[model samples]
Target chain A: MNILVLLRMVPDVVEELEIAPDGRTLDTEYLRMIVNESDDHALEQALILKERKGGKVTVLALDAPDVDDVLFSAVAKGADRVMKIEGGDGGVTTRAAAGMFAEIIRNEKDLQPFDIVLTGVQAIDDLDALVAPILSHRLGLPYLAIVTKVTPDATGKSVTAIREFAGGVRGEFDVPLPAVLGIQAAEKPPRYVPVAKVRAAMKTSKIESIGVPTMADGGQPLLDVSHMRKPVVSGHAQMLDGEPEDVSKKLAGIFTERGLL
Target chain B: MSGNIWIVAEQWRGKLSEITFESLALGREVADGLGVKLQAVLLGHDVQNLSTSLGMADSVIYVDHTELADPGASAQASALAQLVRQQKPRTVIVPLTNVSLGTGTLLGEQVGAPVVNFCKDLRAADGHIVADCVLYGGKIEATVTPRGDLTVIGLWPGSRPPDKGRSDRNPPVETQTVTFADQPSVKLRSYIEPDASDVDITQQDVLVAVGRGIQSQENVALAEELAASLGGAVCGSRPVIDQGWLPLSRQVGKSGLNVKPKLYLALGISGAPEHLEGMKDAPLIVAVNSDPDAPIFNVAHYGVVADAMDMIPTLKETVLALRG
Candidate 1:
C-alpha cells in the first residue's frame, strides 16, 4: 500500500506577529516555522495505519528550501520518505499552497497511484480547512472530512471509517480504495520522535524538492486586514461590582439594557 | 454578469436560514459600492417561491429541486459552477457552513478563482471584493483579495451584521434547474432526527456559549450561572461535547444547531469560523476572553478583554441586577 500525507509547514502559530509599517501585510521575519499541528496528527495516524497494515508512507510539504528541521522531525517520527517542494517562501494560504502540493503529487512517478491519502481536517495555519475537499476534487477522488477513525482491509481495497455528523451522530462509510480522508483529532498523538533514530533518519532520509503551482481562484474578502499584528482589544472592561449571584443578575441586566440579553 | 455582486442565497430543506437574509443585507453593501445590479442565487429542493423574499436583488435567479435536500460538496459545486459559468458575477458569497466550505472551495477551484474561505471583514470596491480573515487558531489575520484576478469569497457568518431591512422592490431572476451530479458518495438512506421531545439550546432566546477558553468540566458552573440568571440555555463549542462536559445536544457549530437569538455571549471562546457561523445571526454579540488576542473580539460588538472565569462571576451579578 502507498500512503500519502499532506504535511504543511507554517509560521509557528505561537510566535507574536509583527505588522509591516504599511498595513497591507504582515512581516514574515522573526517568524519560526513548524509542521502544522493537525498535520502532525495526520502523519501520526498514517504511521499507525502503516504499522498495522505495512505500507510505505510519504510526507509532502511546501516550504522554503530549509524547512528540513520539521521535515527531519516527520521522518524521525514515522515517514519513510519526505518530499519538500519549493512553493515560494512558506506559510501561504491553503488555496495557494495546496495547489502547489497537488501539482507535485500529480507529477510524482514513484508514488503508486496512492492506495489512500490523509490530511488533518484543518491546518492550524490557514484554518480554511477547505483544501482536503478541493484536493479530493482536483485528484478526482472521493473525500470524507472530519473522519474520526479508519479501518482498512489487507488489500487496501475498501475501508470503513467513522465520521461525525451534526449532534454527535456517528456515520460509518464503506469507502472504496484510493480515497482521501481528512482526519480530525484521534485517540492518540503520533508516537514521540525518538532521539536515537532521529540522527539516522535525518542523515539518510532524502528531502525531494519540487516546483510550486499557480493558484486559480483565491477569493476576495470584502474586508482586507490592514496589518498582521497580534489581536488587540484594548480597553478596560468594567468589572460589575457585586457577589456571585448579584454579579450574575447584574450582568444579565446590563445585557438586557443594551438589548443584548 | 460583468458588474454584479453574486449572492448565493442559501436555503436548506425548504427553509432559508437567517444568514441568507443577512448575506443579502451584506450583499447590498457590496452591490451599492460596486455600482452594479444585485443578483441572488437561491438553491434548495422545491424552493421555487423562496426566491420571492430576495426581492432586493436586481435579478433573483432560482435553482430548485428535490435532490438539493441532500446537497453535498460535489453536487452543489457542480450546480453553482454552472451558474457561475453562465452569470459570471463579480463575486460569490456563500454562508460559511461545512457544506458551504466544501462546495464553495470546490467551485473556486473548478473555476480557478480565489475564494475567501471565511471572512468577517467583507467589502467590495473597484470591481473587486476584499476580505480579511483569521487563520492558525486565531493567531494572525491574513488579508485576502477576493477580487484579486480570480478570487471569490465565502462569507464569515458572525462577522457581518444581521439584516436590518431589505427592499420590497422586485425583479425575478431567471430560474435554471442546474444539472449536476446529485450523487452523495455516501447516500443518506434515511435521516433519524433527534426526538424533538428533547429541548435544543439553539431555540432559546439567550445562549451562554462556553468555548475552550473555559478551563475544566467543573468550571462550567460559572457559565451555567450566567445562563440561569438570564433564564436562558447553555451550550458549548465542539470540544465541550467531545469531552462529555455537555450533552451533544448542546454543541453549536456547522455540525450542530444553527441559531439566531436576541443575544449570544461567547465566553472564553476563541471564535473559529465554524463556531461563529452558527451564531453570527444573533442580534447582539458579547465576548469575554482573558487573552485580548482571541479572535472572538473581531466579530463581537461588545467585548471585555478579561478572563471569562472572573468576568462570568461579575457579569452574572450584572445580569441578576439588570433582571431585577
Candidate 2:
C-alpha cells in the first residue's frame, strides 16, 4: 500500500494575529506557524495504517515559513518520504492550494502511485475545508471527510472509512481504493516526536524539493477579500469584581435569584 | 444576471437540521435585500413533506431521489449543480456543517461558480453581494465578494436565530427530476448512535461546561459537584472531549449537541467559534477563565477572570449554602 499525506502549516491561533498593512492578509512578521492540528492527525493515521498493513507513507507539504521543520518532524515520526513543493506561500487560497497539490501529485515522477491520499478535515485559516473535495474532483477520486478511522481489506481493493457526523453519530462507508480522505482524528492521538529525534532526522533525511507547476489559469481566486479586521466586540461582559470567594458568593446569589439552585 | 436566492435544505434522519432553518432566515434577509424570491431547495427521498415547514422560502424546489437519501455529498452536489445550471439562481446558500460541508464547494467546482464559505453576514451592496466571514476560529473577520454571476455560499450557523426562519404558511412546492450519469463511489454502510445510557446535556436547564482548563479527569469531579448543586448537568468543550476526559455525549460544540440552557456556566472555555455555535443561544451565560482575552467573554453576560479550578469548588460550596 502506498499512502500520501498532505501537511499544511497554518498560523498558530494561540498567538495574537495581527492584520498586515495590506489589510487583506495577516501580518507575517513575528507570526508563528505550526502544523495544522488535524493535519498532524492525518499523518498519524497514515502511519498507523502503514504500521498495520506494511506500506510506505510519503508526506508532502507546500513551501512556507516554518514548513521545513514540519517536514523534518514528519520524517522523525516514521514517514518514509517527505517532499516540499516550492513557490507556494502561506497566502494561497484553498482553491489554489488544491490546484497546486493536484498538479504536484500528478506530475511528481519519483513518487510511487498512491492508493490513498489523506489531509486534515479543516484548517483554522481555511475553515471552509474545500481542499480535499476540490482535490478529489480534480483527481477524479472518491472523497470522504470527517473520517475517524480507516481499515483496508486484505485484498487491498477497498477500505472501510468511519466518518463522524453531528450529535455523536458515526457512519461507516465503503470506499474503493485510490480515494481521498479528510481525516478528522486518528485512532490514537498523534504520537509525540522528541526534539532530539527531529534534529537527528533533519541532519540525516533529505527533503526532495519540487518546483510548483504553473497553475492552470493562474489559479484565479474564487473569492476576494475586500477588508479584514478583528471581530467587532458586540457586548462587553460585566466583569466580576474580586477574589474567588467574593466572585463565588456573588455567583451563588445570582443563581439563587434565578432559581437555578 | 438577476435571479432568485436559493438555500439548500439539509435533512438527516428524516428531520431538517437547525442550520437549515438558520440558513433560511439568512436567505430571507439577503433575498429581501436583493428584491428576489427566496427559494428553498429540498433534495431527499420521500422527504417532500419536510417542505411544508420551510415557509420562509417563496417556493420549495423539491427533488426526490434514492441516491440522495443518505446525504452523500457527491450525489447531492451533482443534483444541486444540475439544478443551478438550469435554474440560474443568483446565489446558492448551503449550510456549513459536517453533513453538508462538501456540497457547496463541490457544486462550485462542478458549475464553475465562486464559493464563499464561513459567511457570518451578507448584504446587498451597489448591486452586488458582500459577505462578512469569520476566519481563524473567530479571531479575524474578512469581508469578501464572489467574482461571478452566480455564487455558492457556505453559511456558518448562529448567523440568524432559527425562530425567525420558522413560519406557519406553507410555501409552494415544485417537484423536479434529475438523472445521474454514475453512482456515487462512497456508500454509507451503517450509523453508530451515541450511547443511550449517558445523560442528555441538551435537556439540562443549567450546565457547567468545562474546557481545557479543567486540568484533569479528577477536576471534572469538582465540576460535577458544582452542576449537582445548581441542579444541572456537566458538559465539556471539544478539547475536553477530545482528551477522553468526558464521553462524546457530554460534549457541547458544533459536532456535538446544541444546548440552550437557562444558565450556562462556561469554565475555562476559550470559546472557539465551533463551541460558541452550540451554546451561544443560552439565556444567561457566565464565564470563568484565567485569560481575560478569551473569546468566551465576548458572548458571556458576566465574566470572572480567575482560574476555573479554584472557583469550581468554592462556587459549589457557595451555591449549596445559598440554597440552604
Candidate 3:
C-alpha cells in the first residue's frame, strides 16, 4: 500500500490580502503563504495510513513561496519521500494543476504504482475544489471527496472511505484501490513537528525537483478573472468601541432593548 | 451559440436539497437574461414525481436509473455528461454541496468544458455569461468570464432566495436515458447519521457562537457561561467542533445546522461563507473578534474589534447585571 499526498500553499488569510497593481491577482510582495489547512490534514491522513498499513508515504507539492519549509516539515513528520514540482507561482488554475499532477503520476517512473492519491478537499484560493475529481477523471480512477476516514481491506484490493455530506450526514463507501480522495479531515488533528526536527530532516532529506511539463492547449483557464477586489464593506454593523466593560455595557443595553436579556 | 441553461437538481434520501432550488433561482435569472430555456435535470431512482416542484424551470429533464439511486459523483457526472453531449446546453449549473461537490468538475472534464465554481452570482453579459466568485473564504471577490461557449458553473449555497425558485405550476417533464460504460468503482455501504440525542441548536433563540479564536477547550466554558447568563445556548464554528471542544450537534455552519436565532452573538468567528450560510439570516447578529476585517462584520448588526476572550466574561456579567 503506497500513498501519495498532495500539498498546496495558499495565502494566509490571517494577514490582510491586497490586490495587485494588475487588479487581477493578489499582491505577492507582502503575502504570507502557509500550507492549506485541509492539505495539512491530507498529509496527516497519509502518514496515519502509512503507520497503520506499513506502507511508504510520499508528499508532493507545487513550487511556491515557503514551499521548502513545508517539504522539510513533511520529512520530519515521517514522510518517506518529498517531491516538488517546479514552475507554479501560485497562479495556476485547478484544471491546469490537476493536469500537471496527473502527468507526473503517470509518467514519473520513480513514483510508480501508487495505491492512493490524497489531496485537500478544497483550498481557500481554489474554492472550486476541482483538482481531485479532474485528476481522477484524467487518471481513469474512482474519486471521492469530503472523506474523513480510509481503511484498506485485508486483500488490499479496495478501501472503505467515510464520506461526509451536508448536515452531518455521512456515507460509507467501498472504493477500489488506485483511487483519488479529497480529504476533509484526518481522523486526528495534524501532528506538529518541532522546528529542530525539521531542521535535522532538512539536512538528511533530499527533495526531488521535477520540471513542469509542457501543458496542452486545453490547460488554458476556463474562467478568466476580470478583476479582483476586497468585498465592499456595507458598514452595516454599529461598531462598539472603548474598554471591555464599556463595550459590554453597550452590548447589554442593546440586548435589553431587543429583549434578549 | 444558442443553447439551453441546465440546473442539476441535487437530491438526497429521496428529497431535493435546498441548493437545488437556489440553483434554479439563479439559473432562471441567467436563462432569462440569455433568452434561453431553463431546464432542471433530475436524476434519481423512482423519483420522477420530484419534477413537479421544479416549476421554476421551463422544463425538467428527468433521468431514472437504479445505479443513480445512491450514485457517486462519477455515476452522476457520467449520466449528466451523456445528456449534455447530446443537448449541448450552453451553461450547466451545479450546486456546490457535499453530495454533489465533484459533479460539476467531473462533468466539465468529461465533456471538455471549462468549469467556474464557487460562483455566487451569474449574469449574461453581452451574450456571454459572467460570474462573481468568492475567494479566500470571502475575503476577496473575483469577477470571471468563461473563455468557452459551453461552461459549467458550481453555484454556492446562499446565492439566491430559495422561495423565488418554488412554484406551484408543474413544468413539462422530458425523460432521458443514459447507460454507464462501466460500473462505478465507488459503492455506498451505509449512511451514518448524526447523533440525535444532543440538544438541537436550531431551536434556540439565542446562540453564542465560538470559533478558533476561543483557543482551547477551557475557553469554551467562557462561551457557555455567557450563553447561560443570556438564557441562550453555546454553539461553535467548524474549527471548535473539529477540535472536540464542542459536540458536532453544537456546530453552526454548512455541514452543521442552519441556525436562525433571534440574536446571534458571534465570538471569535471570522464568518466564512460556509458559516455565514447557516447564521447570516439571524434577526440580530453581533460579532466580537480581534480582526476588525473579519467577514463576520459584514453581516453583523453590531461589531466590536476586541478579543473575544476579554469580552466574554464582561459580557456575561453585564447581561446578568442588566437583568437584575
Candidate 4:
C-alpha cells in the first residue's frame, strides 16, 4: 500500500486577515503560515494506513513558506519520504496545483504509482475544494470526497470507504484502489510529535525538490476577482448597552414585547 | 446550446432539496445577464412532478433512470456529463453540498471545463462570470473570474432565497434518455443516520444554541433552563455535541439541520461560517459571548459582550418574571 498525502500551508487562521490594497486578495505582510488543520489529519491518516498495511508513506506539498518545516515534521512522524515541488505563491488555484501535482506524480523518477492519495476535504485558504477531484481527473483515477474511514480490501485491489452526508448521515462505498480521496477526518486524533523529535529529523531527513512545468496561465485560473470589500452585516445588529445584568433585563423586556416569554 | 445557463436541480428520495431552488434563483439571474435562457436539469427515477415546481426556469430538462433512484456522485456526474455534452450550456450551477462536491467536479472534468466551487455570489462581467468566494473560514473574501467558455459552478446554499424563484407559471419539462455506464469503481452500500432527538430543532420556533464557550456539561443546563423558560428548544454547536453534552440531532451547521427559527439566542457561539450558514436567516438573533469580536456579532440582531455562563441563569429568571 503506497499512500501519498498532499499537505498545504495556510495563514494561521487565528490572525486577522486584511485585504490587500488591490482589494482582491489577502495582505501577506505579517501573516503567519501554518499547516492547514485538516491537512495535518491527512498526513496522520496516511501514516496509520502505512503502519497497518506495511507500505511507504510519502508527504507531498508545494514549495511555500514554512513548507519545509511541515515536510520535516512529517518525516519525524514516520513518513518514508517528503517532496517539495517548486512554484506556488500561496495563491495558486487548486486546479493549477492539481495539474502540477499530477505531472510530478507521473514523472518523478523515484516515485511509483500510489495505491491511495489522501488530501484534506477542503482548504481554508482557497475553499474551492477542487484539488483532489481535479487530481483524480488528471490521473484518470476514481475519486471520493468527504470520506471518514478507509479500509483496504484483503486483495488490495479495492478499498471500502465511508462518506459523510448531511444531518450526520454516513454512506459506505467500495472504491477501487488507485484512487484519490478527500479526507473529512482521520481514524483518530493526529498524534503529537515532540518538538525535539522534529528538530532532530530536520538534520537527518532531506526533502526532495522537484520543478514543475507551468501550464497555460497556470491553468488559466478560471475566475479573476474584479473587486472585493468587507461583507456587510445586513442584520443591523443593535448592540445592547450597560452591564450584563442590565442587558439581561433589556433582553427580557424585548422577549416580553414579542410574546416569546 | 452554448449560451444557455443550466441548473442541476438536486432531489433525493422524490423530494427536492432547498439548495435546488436556491440554485434556480441564482441561475435565473445568470441566464438573464448572459442574454440566454435558464433551464433546470432534474435527474431521478420518477421526478416528473417535482420538475413542475421549478417554474422559474424557462424549461425543465430531466433524465429518469433506475440507477438514479439512489444517485451517488459518480452516477449524477455521469448523467449530468451526458446532458452537458448534448446541450453545451455555457454554465451549469450546482448546489454546494457534500454530495455535489464530487459530482460537480467530475462533471466539469468530464467535459474538460473549468469549475469554480463554493461560490457565495456570481455576476456576469464582460461575457464572463465573476464570483465572490469566502475563504479562510469566511474571514476573507476573494473575487474570482472562472476563465473559460464553459464553467461549472457549485453555488453555496443560502446565497439566494428559494422563494425568490417562486412564480405562477410552470416551465415546460423536457425528458431525455442517456445510457449510463456502470459505476463499478465506487458503490454506495448503506446509509447511517443519527438517532432522532426528543425535540426536532427544525420545527422549533425558537432555539437557544450553545457553543464551546458554555465550558462544561453542567453549563449546558443553563442554556437548557433559559430555553425552557422562553418556550424554545436547546441546541449546541459541533463541540458540544462531540463532547456528548448534546446529541448529533441537536447540532446546527452545514453538516446539520438548517434552522430558521423566529428567534435564535446564540450563547458563547462564535459564528464560524458553517454554523452561521445554518441559522443566519433566523429573524431575530441575540448573541452573548465574552469576546466582543466573535463573528456571531455580525449576523446577530442584538448582541451582549458577556460570558454566557454568567448571564444565562439571570436571563432565564428575568424572562420568567417578565412573563408573569
lDDT, each prediction: 0.68, 0.88, 0.89, 0.80
List TM-scores for all candidates, in order.
Answer: 0.75, 0.94, 0.97, 0.87
Q: Candidate 2, clashing residue pairs?
A: none
Q: Please list the Cα RMSD from the true structure of every candidate, rounded to 1 decimal place.
A: 5.8, 2.1, 1.4, 3.5
> Across residues B216-305, which tens digit of lDDT does each residue of candidate 1 receive?
888897788878887787888866665557765787876777777677888888776678667765777778776665666777766666
Candidate with more favorable, higher DockQ: 1 or 2: 2
For each candidate, report what fraction of the true interface contacts it reproduces. Answer: 0.28, 0.76, 0.83, 0.69
| Candidate 1 stretches greater than 4 Å from native | A12-15, A32-37, A44-56, A64-80, A124-129, A149-175, A187-261, B64-67, B134-151, B159-162, B165-173, B181-235, B239-247, B257-268, B276-290, B297-324
Return the TM-scores of chain A for each candidate in numbered order.
0.79, 0.94, 0.96, 0.89
**Per-residue alpha-carbon lDDT of model 4 for B208-286, expressed as tens digits?**
9999899889989878988988888899885576466887689898667789998899998878777888899888899
Q: Write the per-residue lDDT of candidate 2 for residues A58-144, one digit (tens) a residue.
A: 998888888889998999999989998886544788777878888888877656578999998888777333788888888888999
Top candidate on lDDT is 3
- TM-score for model 3? 0.97
Q: Which ten-residue region of model 1 chain B has the weakest summed lDDT?
A: B182-191
Q: Give the deviation of candidate 1 from the true structure as CA RMSD.
A: 5.8
What's the best-to-worst order under TM-score? 3, 2, 4, 1
Candidates ranked by DockQ: 3, 2, 4, 1
Q: Please say which candidate is ahead in DockQ: 3 or 4.
A: 3
